[model samples]
Target: MRQQLRRQAGAHSDHLQDVLAVQERELKRRFEAAHEDRLRAERHKFQAELAVVMGELKGVRDAITARADLDRAAHHAQEMWVACQGLKQAIRTGQLGAASWQQQLKPLRDEVAAIRQVAGEANRFVESVLTSLPEEVLERGVYTEDALRERFCKVERLCKRVNMIDDEGGSLFKYALSYLQSLLVVDAFERLPGKEQRDESISPKLNTYEIIARARYCVDKDDLLQAVRYMSLLQGEPRLVASDWVRDTRLMLEARQAADALLAHAAATGLQAL
Candidate 1:
């Protein structure tokens, strides 16, 4: 009985040792699985954070590009505005005359048109860029330089035409002297007989009046110099043949010279060149 009892106690001890070994293995497996799960959770958290940061970075880059484009467009518009203002000032000052004003129209029109086109393009670009944003944010006024230049050019051309006509009329008076000279050379008084000249002196007087009439006609219809030349001929006739001839000649010469001087000054100034 004593031997059997000892054997049973040894068996029970072996069984308990086996059960403890199995429990130890199961505990180790559970611990390893828990650690792997924790590692996977940490990796997933890091990946999610990295994706969010990349999205934020892309948004920042896009905003920067949009803002840069807007700045460049605005700068160009400002430059165009300045150019238009300068053109306007030049027109107002009369520094640009009719011919010059007309000539400038082509370039001014082109520039203004180009500016408008560019502004339109820029507006479209801004609109597209801000399509997601509100319209009020991109609102701006449009400028039309071409219209203003057109009006200025028309006025300048009209002024130049008027000036041209005035210059032509003023210069015509210079021809009167030439007319008088021609009359003197022709000796128009010889048209009457010698006896008639001695009688009432009507021949000389008639000759003078004829020359004056001819000169007046030439000056009115043809040229001033032609008239003046004829007038001078009548005035310069031999003093022995006519009375009061010297006085009349001096007066006509003086008047012709004054007109010539006025015309010369106008020509030199380029006012009559147009």
Candidate 2:
């Protein structure tokens, strides 16, 4: 009986020892898992920090690039202005030699191209001041065919020198020239007494019908000033004055003095003739 009791006590002691060993092993596994989880969290935090640093660096790089571009544009604009001035001075002095013409002209060409790229109101003003219109041409009014042609040539030369053909002012100047030419032609015909005396006129083939037709053509082309001038010359003919085109053109020139003056003169002349 004593031996049996001792054996039973030893078995119970062995079972308790096994249970303690299993619990210890479970605790060790949990500790190792916790350590791994902490390492992963730390790695994730390091990646996020790296991304923020890269974003800041990229922003700095972009800002530097933008500033560099601005500086370059300013420098180019300054260089172009200086070159244009030199060319203008050379032209005035007549130092543009045939052999060195291209060399001397290079600067102006470069400047014009640069200015065109940066063409704003300020740049346009600078160009106009640099290539100022000729005093002699502006002073004289172009009346005759020869004078008009000569004036046009002078204006065209100025436009080419200044690279101004595409500008608003340039377009207006060209239109003015056309208007003047049409005015001169109509004036020549009006000076003649009648169709029978057409032989005395320069444009002998242009009768009253042709004159009125030309005026209508000018109106169609949106050359109102020229159209008005021609219509003013046609005021001698009552039928033309009553025409639909004439009425429309008169409406267009409703508040203008030029149109009123022509109508007044024609009425006075007709009264005198009667």
Candidate 3:
């Protein structure tokens, strides 16, 4: 009976140890699962915060880029304005040469190729100014009021002898007459009323007399732009005769316009920057 009681006690002890071991394993598994869940939550929170920070940084980068672009455009605009002023001064003083004038405009052609749309338009205008105008005209053909009157006097004297002809040129007869007329370069004589019946204004029709008279009127007013407009209506020999005048007029007008365009665009850019 003593031996049987020892065996029962030993078996009970073994079963109790096995039950404790099972309970410890189950508790460890549950604790490990809870710890894993906490770690996952922390990782997700960190990722969310990182994403928000990255988004903010990206926005800052974009704003900085835009600000930089605006500043660059403004700089180019300022350069263009200065160059245009130089051109206008050259037009007035006739002191600046084509080399210096074109040097001032070089930036627009080479460096500011990627400038804004408005600046690009200004560049195009400047380029046109260069082509439409001759460098020689910048030094010469600076018209004053007195010069206008004297020039118109000569022009009027010539237009007075004009008559309509269907020929492309002033006709072969008129050409011969021109040679003969050149010999009569004696405007020093007193004029009669019949000789004074010159073209005072453009008449009802579009003819050589009207064109020359109207063009002269505009030229007399020192309005080269208007003068060129009327003069452009000429064809054949008249167009050829007035070609130099037209070119000079185009230069003056184009220079002013180019300067105005660049300055205006620059002013607008400065306003936006402010």
Q: Which ranges in model 3 have alpha carbons more than 4 Å from their true place?
A: 1-6, 91-93, 96-213, 220-222, 234-240, 251-274
- Per-residue alpha-carbon lDDT of candidate 3 for residues 36-120, written as tens digits (9 for 90 to 100): 9999999999999999999999999999999998888777767666655554454454433334322222222221222233345
TM-score of predicted structure 2? 0.31
Task: For each candidate in the order shown, give its overall lDDT on alpha carbons.
Answer: 0.42, 0.44, 0.56
- The per-residue C-alpha lDDT of model 1 at residue 265 equals 36
TM-score of each: 0.29, 0.31, 0.57
Q: When superposed on Cα atoms, how far off is each prediction in RMSD?
A: 24.7, 21.0, 8.2
- The lowest-lDDT stretch of 10 consecutive residues in candidate 1 is 135-144
Distance from true location, Cα of 44 in model 1, Å: 4.4
Instruction: Order the candidate numbers by TM-score, best to worst.
Output: 3, 2, 1
Report the C-alpha lDDT of model 2 over 36-152, residue by residue, as the tens digit: 899889999999999999999999999898777766665654554444443334332222443532232222333333434543455555445334423321232112222222333
Going through the candidates in the order shown, the clash numbers are 21, 0, 0
> Which pairs in model 2 have colliding backbones?
none
Q: List the residue pairs that clash in candidate 3.
A: none
Write the residue-wise lDDT of candidate 1 on 53-87 in tens digits.
99999999998988777666556545444444443
What is candidate 1's TM-score against the reference? Answer: 0.29
